[model samples]
Target: MDLQRQIRNGWFFFLKHIFNPLTRRIARTSFGPFAIVRHVGRRSGKQYETPIIVSPAKDGFVIELTYGPDVDWHKNVLAANGCTVVWHGKEFAVDKPEPLDTETGRAAFPPPQQLVLNLLGRKHFEKLTCKKDE
Candidate 1:
């Protein structure tokens, strides 16, 4: 893994880190309530799960604004359109990803999540794109 990804993963999973759940509480719940997302990985096709604030995309839901490319989950969804997510313990289908331009496009998150991203980070990729996560 790359250095930045290593650092991010360590801080995220390690309970001792200050930026762990303590500092990132808002991120974990930034979207009012978490929405489960299921996507495969670019390198590994195994299913991965992540929770994030989401909003409507065309007719279906979108996690973040854009999908595709460097974001592993997005790429996975692009390669495989069908995903199953358990929400409230009920499984639901998430359509295959449809790519969007990161710049000059609608943010796919709801207002609450947009506020969270605006206060936290400015990266369009991070705010709009989904990553390979577990």
Candidate 2:
């Protein structure tokens, strides 16, 4: 395998087995920019909670697609048209998952997060609207 693919695979494995478990514990807390996204598998019918960095927007939240838009979690959210986000110790039902322009998505985050994301070469982002009470 090419070195780049090998490295990416290794990093994914590390994140799945080590980083995610440790981060999941605090991602849903009322501090920091971390959040937990609860979604179900599209094919497996299994539930999952993924830790991610979330930035609140005027109407909802902007999520950086660190692994790009084709990632399983993103696909699942799109397929279901929504998911639950645990942020700042509160659960929010979000819907209308859609892709955002690079500039718009980056603008949702603070300067620090934008800098980090830029450094990581992240250009894709998804927006989820807060579900209004009926």
Candidate 3:
């Protein structure tokens, strides 16, 4: 692996295995814009709950790729065709995870969120449309 990927993986290991525990507990209560996306593994057949930061979008939600788009949760969501996201005191079954460019993706966020994304160098984002209730 390249140095950049190695660095990213090291940070990911810390975030997913260590820091996420604290974030998960706080995120579960609907505080902030944190969400728990429940998705199954593509190959392992394991269920995983990944905490992410999201913002309300036109029809669904916009998620910034904090650790970049190569993360496993995003891949899992893509492979599974959808995932359930618990956000802002409600659970939403969202599909159609469309990848967007920095301009379009950042447009979905408020000023504060947009500023943060800019500072973080986040260029890719996903727009997941909420599935309507039957």
| Candidate topping TM-score | 2
The top-ranked prediction according to lDDT is 2
Model 1 weakest lDDT span, ten residues long = 122-131
How far does residue 112 in candidate 1 sit from its true spot (Å)? Answer: 3.1
Question: Number of clashes in every candidate structure?
Answer: 2, 0, 0
Residue-by-residue lDDT tens digits, candidate 2, 59-122: 7899987778778988888888899999988899999578889888888999998898888888
RMSD of 2: 1.8
Per-residue CA lDDT of model 3 for 48-115, tens digit only, reads: 98888888888899988787878888899999899998886678999959988889988888888889
> What is the Cα-based lDDT of residue 57 in candidate 2?
89
- Which pairs in model 2 have colliding backbones? none
CA RMSD for every model?
A: 7.6, 1.8, 2.8
Superposition error at 13 for model 1 (Å): 3.9
Alpha-carbon lDDT of model 3: 0.86
Cα error, candidate 1, residue 75 (Å): 2.7
